[model samples]
Each structure stands twice: as structure tokens, then as C-alpha cells.
Target: MDFNFTEEQDMVRDGLSRMVREQYGPEERRQLIASDAGWSKAIWGQLAELGILGMSFSEEDGGFGGGAIDSMVIMEEFGKGLVVEPFVPTVVCAGGFLKHAGTAAQKEEHIGGIVSGERVFAFAYAEPRGRYDLANIETTAKKDGGDYVLNGHKAVVIGAPWASHLVVTARTGGERTDAQGISVFVVDKSADGIVTRDYATVDGRRASEVYFENVRVPADALIGEEGNALPLIERVTDEAIAAQCAEACGAMKVAHAMTLDYAKQRKQFGVPIASFQVLQHRMVDMYTEYECSVSMTYLATLRLDADERTRKEAVSAAKVRVAQAAHHVGQEAIQIHGGNGMTDEYAIGHYFKRLTIFDSEFGNIDHHMKRHIALAS
Candidate 1:
């Protein structure tokens, strides 16, 4: 199968690439993350103007009618600049849910704001006790008169502080950890009885520990059928994993490039360190890992529409390889950069931190390895 991008896809990538180079330099990104908002609303508006926020939705949903490959293109660029925006949360995760299963009214109400960049969304799914298990929900949504009252805490909700709404998961009927009874809702973040304690993460993005205390949402807020949303959740998350793997590939590419440039510039024994054959071999190894990751990411993204078992197996397998590449490239970049790489002022270290945290997102290396094994079985 052909892996080349279409002309439109190439155009979107080149435009976004130029935008990242001009607008989000390393210094600009560093400062943006340091600010209280921890991201740039101005840049978000720029993305809206460029029609990126809507790139992955259907035309009926006020989008340009893009798909997972579109998201992969956009996210790879976002990763290069280490953008701290809520693209993954708002566009990939929440948008995936709406595009796949939302009611017409839900799409009409939410997708417009999202495409226009007037709204941001965070995915509040993982609990303090839930370690990578999508069905392990301790939060509950109980049926009330014409509404569902949500009560539970979501831990490490990425981008929550900046979100206007949340795509949240909760148990609606069956016991915790059961595949049945897990439901999803679109909740207004500022609703009564909702609380958030936000902080900066090691990777320069923001996250929150969010609590829902008797927060009532209209029945219309439900994204899919109650107690039967796990399959939908899995599908969306697999799509997300594809996008995220592309992002990691972008990060690895930049990290390896930076190390190569540093080696060419830094001198030892009156010659560039790059002149040394041993270091050259290491750099080559890093490049190889990055390329391998790119191929695996492509595999995952392409297989998203396959059967459930096929899709899950491909995503998990890709994630395992990509995570390993991220770790190897990140460590090598730092090692090649030596003492300077360890400084917070340098951008390579920041890249390293992002790559490190990337391993834990969606699922870790071991987690995906086990998942792939289970699918194989």
C-alpha cells in the first residue's frame, strides 16, 4: 500500500510546519508553558484560522472531513514544537467520540465550538486506582429525574485546567472493572460541584486532579448508550494511540536531529565529536530507531479501521516499538549532549522529558506488550 500523503495532506503539513517554525520557537514554547495558562490561546486561534481544529471530523460536523491520518499529520507537527495545547484532548479524544457516536444535537452544539476554537475539552477517564484499564471505573453516574448525577475523582486529567468541557467516564450500573455499565458523558467543566486542582507537569503541560460531587448533567450529555460504551471508548482510544504515536515519532526525529547537530558543533581533541566513529555509530543507531518507529506508527494509523482484534493488536504493537524508540533516542540525545543537555534551559532536555512521559500515556511499553500478546492469543 502507498504511504505517501496526498497533495492536500502535504499542504496541511507544510503550512503547519512553517507555522511551528515561525510561531513556536523553543524559547516561545518555554515561556508559554511557564505562564499560568501554560499554553497559547493565540496559537489556538491560529490553528482555528488555519482550519486545523476541524481537520479530523466529518463535513456534517462542521469539519473539513478529515480522519485519523489527518490527526497524525497535525499531531506530528505539534510534537515538533512541543506544543502544550489541548489538541489531543480536545480534537483527538473528545472529537473522536462526537464524530463516531454523538447525537445530532450534541455534534451541532459541541463540534461547532470545537472547530471554531471557542471550546476546549479534556478527557477525564483514568482514576487513581485505574491503571490503564478502560473498564476500571470507580466514578458513578446515577440516574436522577431527567439527569445523571456524576460523583467521582479523575486523576491526572491532562489539559483540564484549560478545558471548557470534559469527556468523562463513569460507572452507571455494573460493579467496578466490569466491561458492562461503563458510560461516558460530556460535562461542562464549570458546572456546580466540580472542582479542579491544577498544576504543571514535568513535560511543561498542565494537568488536574478533578472531582465531581453530585454534578448533574442532562440525559442528552451521554455520548453513547449507557452501560455499553466500552467498545466505543476502546475505538476512540485506539485512534488516539495512533495520533500519539505519530507525535512521539516527531519528537524522536527532532531529538535525534538535535543530537546530530550538537555533535557536529561541539569539539573534542581539536575535531568535532561527530568525527569520532564510535559516536557516529551511536547517532546512526538513534536514526535507525526513529525510522523503525515511523514505520510502526504508519502501520497503526493505517490499520485503525480493521476488525477490533486487528486494530488493537496493531496499535499495541506499534506503541511498544515506538515507546522503545522514544526511550532510546531520548537517552542518547541527552548523553550525546552531555552536561549541557541536563540543563533546564536547553530544549533537548525538555524533549527528553516529553518523551519520558510519553511512555506512560495511553499505556506503557510493558502494558502494550502484554496487550499485544493477549490479542495474539
Candidate 2:
């Protein structure tokens, strides 16, 4: 029932906050994003040195044996810093799948590299037609001699530009959109017949439209049992949703604080706008939304180990609330900063753009609302 972080968790949180504050200021982040890789490998290595790259795994997997709460702490700080690193794609999404479904040898081979920050991974699950449905896979995987051949196209694969490996979903049995036939595979990024069209996204991150034409991998590339990856995929996706909600909370907190400070400084009618009753009321509303979002994020994270239904329901609820708060806080931040907020030179507009990306990723407000309603029914 207690929501307060334990000493260890607090330590990790504070350490990560201090590291980000000292290293990833707005100007530094801008320079990093403008670089060719669109992210900082130096910062990524520092995170590994700090043991944050391993926070989501267990001790046996070369991690600190932390859980969702630990991941939330690190991700919240990453969000605050507007990190362009592919931590979520590599450590959260791909690593979750590996930890839950990979063989022991697979774990050692893939997860070891992940924990050391030597390898980056992208979840190549999204298809051109797939919009939030985890089971909607159109890519086909067929049995070959001691291997599987994959052929399909994945859309908007975030982090693919920097990824050395990919966790891809394909149809091994049933029709597209059917849950019974999906499977997941670990594919090398430089494999033959693989073509990637990479570009920078609106939020200062990179993504790729990846095409697979007769891509072949050994049978050992399978993550878990064949034709039974739906359950695992769904579970990992839910974890990602929870993490995204937490990150959104962090971004919203920054946006709210920035807006308040701007209000206090920007004078109108010979007085600070923050002194105006209307602006004060708006700030109060932003704070209320942020606090509510924090409570919901914690509730969802605490419920991750509960029954599947309970956990998913809580995640959907938290995502819904977080999405609402993100929109409200992002817009208000921009409004408070006036025309200057729309410029790329200011950090507030960038925060708003990141919030907008968060709102659309995994699932949006309306998507989670429908999901929550379904769970309630």
C-alpha cells in the first residue's frame, strides 16, 4: 500500500537524475541528436557503467535483479533528459522478450551483450497495416532445412538505424491478424536480403522501414515455442506500455515546471503572467493532472505481477491517464512560452514533440479507453 520508494530505489533514482543533469543538458542533447547516429554512444556506455542498462533483468542475467519499479525510475530520468538513446527498444522491449522466452544459451549470448551495451536491438513488430494490435503479423516465416526464411516488411522500426540485431514477428501458421500463428525471431541486421530505409523522426529519434526478402536464419533464432509467441508478445508489449506511461509522466513533470517558470518571467500588462488568476488556475490544473498521472503510473507498475487481466487493466488505465496529462501539459507549456515555444531553439517545444510521440506510441488515449472498457465488461 505504501507508494514511497525504498532506499535502494531512491538511490538509483537520485543517481540517474544527477548523472543526466550533469551530462545531458539541453545543448548537449541537441548536439548529440544532430550527430550522424542521432544518439550518444558515450552516454549509453556511461549508463551501462552505472548499471542502468541492466536494471530490467535479474542477477542471473548479469543485472541487479530489479523489476518494473527499477525500470520506471531509470526511464523517468531518461525522459526528463529527453534522451535520444534506444534504451526502450533495446533494454525494455527486446530484452523483455529475451528474458522471458529465450533459451539459457540465447540469454547469455544476447542479454550479455545488451547488459554490456555492446549490442543494440530493435523490435521489428510493426507492419504497414498493424496499428496497435500485437497479433497482427503479415510477415511470413517458413520452415527450411535447419532454418526459417522470413519475407515481409516492417514499418517504423524505431532504433533500427543503430541496432545490430532485431526481434521480429512473423506468421508461422495462421492468417494475418489471427493470434494462433504468430512467431518471433532474432535476426541480424546485416543479413542478406534485408533492406532498411532509415530516417529521423519528429521526436529527434531514428526509425527504419525494414524489408525482408527471403531472409534466412537458423532454427536457433526462435525466441520461444513456435506458433505460440502471442502470449509472450502481449505481455512484453504491456510492460512497454507501463514504461511509456512512466516516461510520459516524467516529461509532463518537466513541461509543467518549465511552463510555471516561464509564466513567472514573462510579464504582461506590467505584471508577471503567473500572477494573473487565470494563468494560476491553468498551472493548478496542470499540476493536478501530473499528480494524478504519477499515482496511476505507480498503481499500474505495482500491479504488473498480479493476474494477467488485472495487470493489463491497470496498465491500460494508467496509459489513458498519462496520455491525457501529456497532451494537457505539452500544450500548456507551449502556450506559456508564447511564439518562442514553437521554435526549435527552445527546449519546451521539443518536450511537447516528445509528449506527442509518447501519446501515439504503443497506444493512444482512445485506444486505452476502449481497452479499459473491455476489461471492465
Candidate 3:
């Protein structure tokens, strides 16, 4: 399949890139990182005004009726700018989840606010072990009279500190890793019996550890049918992984460009370092890795709605390639920047850190490699 972007998609990317460059340059990013929210609400509003925040949702939900590829385009631009906003968690993960699995009433109630950037949402799936395994949830939600009582903890819920709501996965029955009886709930952050310990993540993102001690929610809060959320969760996770791979690819491209410019300008011994054969070879390798990542990301995006086996294989392959590419490109960019690369004063250092965090999130290279191999066998 041809992976070329349509004219409209290209325009969307270009417009976003221009906006980010003008509105969220390196200094602006630094200031946002130092802020309490680790992001700018004004920028978020601007994105909403541009219709980018609602780009991937249906028109009935106040969105633009875009798809997975549309999300990938927006996320790539966000990654290029090192945006601290919770676009992926709110727009891609939560919005996609609701669009796919939520009842019509649920979509009408929640998605409009999310698409308008008036309400933020997060996915609380990881537990103390911090694995992305959907079935490893120890959080329990027991059925009560007209409600479900949730009791347990969620670890490292990204954007939870700023989220108005969360999509939490809890075990309704069976063992911790059993797929059976897994359920998803929509929980309000301000509800009684809920506690949150907020913190700044390594990449200047806001996250929190949330506790639900008998937190009660109505039966309608459960997304889709109870005990049948596994398939939906798996599908959303695959799309999330593909979106992240696209972001990583975009970040790697930016890092490569920044390092190339540095090499060309930072002259040493009466000549630009970029003129050196060894440095040229290193740059070539970085470019090659980035190309591979782009190819894999595009392939995975196209397969977002494919058959189960095909989707799984494509996403796993993309995640593995993107992880490797991000690592190689980050390291090479840092190397090219020399001692200055390790300093916080330089944007390259921050870019490298973000790349590292991205590789680790969703699923790392090793995790995807194992999945890919298992599927192959």
C-alpha cells in the first residue's frame, strides 16, 4: 500500500509545524517544563481552535471525522515540538477508546468536551509493576447496588494530575493476569474516596499515582460490556502504539536535523566537523535509521483497522523498529553535539531524553521483539 500523505494531511502537518515553531520554540518549551502544569493551557486552546485537538474524532462528537493517520500526523508535529500537553492520552487513547467501545450516550456525554479541549482525560492501566500488560491489573471493581466500588491503586497515570476524568482498567474477577473479567471504568478525579499523588515525570510530563478506596461509580460508567473489554483494550493499545511510533519517528527526524545543523556550524580545526568523513558516516547512519522508522510507522498506521493478527504483527513490528531507530538517532545526535550534548542548556539533550522516554513508553524494543517473535513462531 502507498503510504504517501494526502494533500490535506500534508497541509495539516505543515500548518501544525509552522504554528509550533512560532508559538512553542525551545525557550517556550523550557518555560512550560518549569511550570506547575508542565504545559500551557493557552497552547492547548490554540490547538483546539485549529481543530487539531478534534482531528481524529467523529463529527457527531464535535470532531473532524479524521482517523488513525490523522492522529499520527498531529502527534508527529507534537513530538517534533517536544509538546508537554497530554494529546496522546486524551485525544488518541481516551478518545479512541470511547469512540470504539463506548455507548452512544457515553460518547455524547464525554467526547464533546474532550474534543473541545475543555476536559482532559487519562488512561490508568499500569499498576505497581509498571508493565503494559492489560491483564496484570490488580485494581478491583466489584458490583454493588446500582454501582461498582473500585478499590486499589494505579501507578504512573500520565496526565492524571491535569485530567478531569480517567479511563481505568480493573479486574472484576479471575486472577491478575487473566483476560476474563477485565473491565474499564470512567472515574471522576474529584470523586470522594479517591486520592492522587502528583509528580513530574523525567521528560517534564505530569503524572500521578491514583488510589481508589471504595470509589463508587454508576453502572453506566463501565465502558462497553463488562467482562468483554479485553478485545477493545487490545485494539486501542495497538493504535496507541502505532501513534507513538509515528511520534518517535518525528522526534528522531528533528534530532537528526538539529545535530546536522550543529555539525555544519560548530567549526573546529579550521573546518566544519560535518566535513569529516567519520561524522558524515555517522549522520548517514542516523538518517538510515530514521527512514526505517518512518517506513514501519506508516505501515502500522495503514494497518490500524486490519484483521487482528495483521494489526498485532504490524504494530509490534513498527514499535520494535521505531524503538531501535529512536535510540540510535538519539545517541548519534548526542555524540555529534559533543560535551554540550549532555548539558540541560542545549535543546539536543532534552530531545534525547524525550526520545528515551518515548522508547520506554507504550512498549520498549525488547517487549515488541518478543511479541513479534512469538507471533512469527
Candidate 4:
């Protein structure tokens, strides 16, 4: 399938690139990172004004009616800018969860606000075990009259510190990983029994450890049917993986460009490094890996609505290839810059750090490799 951006998508990319260059240059990003929120409200508002935050939602939902490919474009630009905003957690993952499984009332109440940037939301799926395996959840939600009482801890909940709400995954059924008792609920972060400990992540983002002690929500808060959210959760995870792969592709592109510029300007052995045949070959390899990532990401995005096995295979393939590409591109970019690459004074260092964090987030190369092998077998 063709992976070239359409005219409209190109316009979207160009607009974002221009905005980031004009408003969120390296210095601005640095200041935002050091701030308490670890992001810029001004930039977030600007993105909303541009309708980028709502571009992927349907028009009836107060969005531009763009699809997965539109989301991929936005994520790619965000990655290139090293945007510290919770765009993925709030807009992509949380919004996707609601769009796919939320009731009509739930969509009317929450999705428009999310699309308009009036509120932020996060997905609370990870637990203390630090695994992306949805079946490994230990959090429980027991029925209490017309409400469900939630009790457990969620670790590394991204954007939770700023989120007004969270889509939480809890055990409501059997004990096995593939048990049918899994369910999802919409929980207010300010609920009486909820406690949050917030911290800064390595990539200058905010994450929180949230504890729920008998937090209760009406049964209507449950997304979709009771004890049937696992399949939806799996689909959301695959979409997240696809989105991350696209971001990795963008990061690799930026890193490659930065390295190329550095090689042409930085001198070694009384000559520019770009003149060296060995260094040139390394840059070529980086370009090749980036192309592979871009191709795989597009494939996964196009096949998002396919059957579970096919979707898993495509997403896992993209994630594995992108994870490997991100690692190689990050290291090569750093190496090309020599000692300066490791310093905070340089933008390349920050890009490398973000790429490292992205590689481990969602699911890493090893995780996707195992998943791919299992699916193939």
C-alpha cells in the first residue's frame, strides 16, 4: 500500500512543523520541561485552536472526522517537536477507549470535552508488576448496590497528575490472564478515596501512582457491557502501539536530519565527518531503518480494523521494527555528535532520551517479538 502523505495530510504536517518551530523552539521546550506541569498550556491551547486535538474524531462528536491516519500525522509531528503535552494519553488512548466502548451518554458527556481540550483523561491499565499484559491486572472492582467499589493501585499512570478522569481496568471475573471477568470503568480523579503520588519521568513528562481504596462509581460508569471490556481493551492497546510506532518513525526522521547536519558541520581529523565513508554508511543504515519503521507503521494503521489475530500481527510487527529502529537511530545520532551528544546543551541528547523512553513504553522490542512469535505459531 502507498504510504505517501496526501495533500491534506502534508498540510497538517507542515502546519505543525511551522508552529513548533515558531512557538516551541528548543529553549521554549526546555522551559516547559522544567515547569511544574512538565508541559505548556499555551502550546496545548494553540494545538486545540488549530483543531489538531479534535482532528481524528467524528464531526458529530465535535471533531474534524479524521481517522487513524490523521492521528498518525499528528503524533509524528508531536514526536518531532518533543511535545511534552499528554496528547497521546489524553487524546489518543483515552479518547480511543471512549470512542470505541463508551455508551452514547458517555460519549456525549466526555468525548466532546476531550476533543475540545476542555479536560484531560488517562488510561489506568498498568499495575505494580510493570507489565503491559492486560490479563496480569490485580485491581478489583466489586459490585456494591448500583455502584462498583474499586480498590487497588495503578503504577506509572501517565498524565494522571493532570487528568480530570481516568479509564481504569479492573478485575471483575476469573483469576487467569485470559479470564472473562475483566472490566473498564470511568473514574474521577478527585473521588473521595482516590490518592495520587505524582512524579517527573525521565523524558520530562508527568506520571502518577494512583491508589483506589473503596472508590465507588455508578454502574453506568462501566464502559460497554459488564465483564466484556477485555476485547475492547486489547483493540485499544493495539491502536496505542500503532500510534507509538508512528511517533518513533517521526523521532527517527528528526534524529537522522540532526545527525546529517552535525556530520556536515563537525570536523574530525581536520575534515568534516560527513566526508568519511564509514560515517556515511552509518547514516545510510539509519535512513534505511527509518524507512522500515515508516512503512510498518502505515501498514498497521491501515489494518487497524482487521480481525484480532491479524491486527495483533500487524501491530506487533510494526512495534518490533520501530523499537529496533528507534534504538539504532538514537544511538547513531548521539555517536555522530561525539561528546556533545550526551550534554543537555544539545537538542540531540533530548531527542535520544525521548526515543529511549518511547522504546520502553507501550511494549518494547522483546515484548512484541514474543507476541509476534506466539501469534504466528
Per-prediction count of colliding residue pairs? 0, 0, 0, 1
Residue by residue across 1-377, what tens digits does model 2's lDDT show?
77788798899999999988998888888888888879888888988898888987999988889988898888888889888888889998989998889999899999889999999999999888887887888899999999999999999999999999999999999888898988999999999999999999999999999999999999999999999999888888888888888888888888888899989999989999999998899999999998999899899989888898998899999988888888888998888889999998899998999998887887788888998999899
RMSD of each: 0.7, 1.0, 1.1, 1.3
Q: CA shift at 313, candidate 3, in angstroms?
A: 0.6
Best by TM-score: 1
Clashing pairs in 1: none
Question: How much does candidate 2 score in TM-score?
Answer: 0.98
Instruction: Name the 10 consecutive residues with the lowest summed lDDT in model 2.
Output: 359-368
List candidate 4 segments past 4 Å from native: none
> Which is the winner by lDDT between candidate 2 and candidate 4?
2
TM for every model, in the order presented, reads 0.99, 0.98, 0.98, 0.97
| TM-score of candidate 4 versus the correct structure, residues matched by position | 0.97
Model 4 Cα lDDT, one tens digit per residue, 1-377: 56687888888889998997787777888888888778777787888888888988888777888878998998888788787788888788888887888878988998888877888888899988847787787889999999999999999998888899998999987884755889999988889899999999887788999999999999999998788888888888888888878887888898999999999999989999999999999999999999999999999999998999999999999988888888899999999899999998899898898888886777788888999999999
lDDT of 1 at 194: 99
Error of 1 at 363 (Å): 1.0
Per-residue error at 349 for model 4, in Å? 0.8
Q: Is candidate 1 or candidate 4 better by lDDT?
A: 1
